[model samples]
Target: MDYQFKLLRQSRQNLLRFTEQFTLEELNEVPEGFNNNIIWHMGHILVTQQLLCYKNAGVPCRISDEIINQFRKGTKPEALVPEEEVTFIRKRLTQTPSLLEEDFRNGLFGEYNEISTSFGNTISNIEEAVVFNNIHEGMHFGYLLALRRALTKTV
Candidate 1:
């Protein structure tokens, strides 16, 4: 479980670094043939982590309902994410994992409601949910990379 958290943190840091190279417009731009932009992918990963780890455990999520509604599964970029919102997401990307680690150590997640992911994975507990979230985040990281390439190519 510690290893899983470490990977999550590393992946998020890498994502932040990757995204930091882009301007606000580039991050918000939906490349041709893509359904969402880099910033959307970033927000989606954050929201998805909360849903999988906190929501599934019957614990309240840290993010607002508006963020969850906007970035949840199957949702796409509806508008340009402003700089302030992007900053909030970036801060959360670094902060949430530490909070989750502390909560896990304190046995915050005692029971979890099983949920099936779109990828056909079943997460029946917090441990599994955390592991699956790493996979989910990796998928979005790939999408962000592809989106970055496309956007840069068009420049």
Candidate 2:
């Protein structure tokens, strides 16, 4: 559990780096062949973590439903995300893992409903959900990387 938490923090650190490295325009730019941009990926990662861990555990999510609707699975960027919202999402990108770690330590998640992920794994508990969330985040982080590369190529 300690290592899982540690890996999650480190992985989020990488995501935070991406957030800092891009401007609002760069983050919002959807490169060719990509359906979404860096900002959407960041938002999606935040929403996905809350949904998989808190919502699936029957606990109230720390984030709002509007965020989940905008960035959850199968969604794409419909309009430019403004600077203020980008800042909010960037703050969440750094803060969420720590808050989640604290919540898990406090046993906020006592039970989790089993969910079959699009990646094909069934998560049955908070620990599994945390672990799987990292896998999901990693996949999106990879997308973030590819999106960055594509955006830079087009520049």
- Each candidate: RMSD: 0.7, 0.9
lDDT of 2 by residue, 97-151 (tens): 8999999999899977998987878899999999998998999888988987898
Per-residue lDDT for 33-151 in model 1, tens only? 99888888999999999999999999999999999999998899888899999999999998999999998999999999998888987899999999999999999888987887898
lDDT of 2 at 98: 90
- TM per candidate comes to 0.98, 0.96
Superposed model 1: Cα runs more than 4 Å off: none
lDDT per model, in order? 0.92, 0.90
Residue 88 of model 2, lDDT score = 90
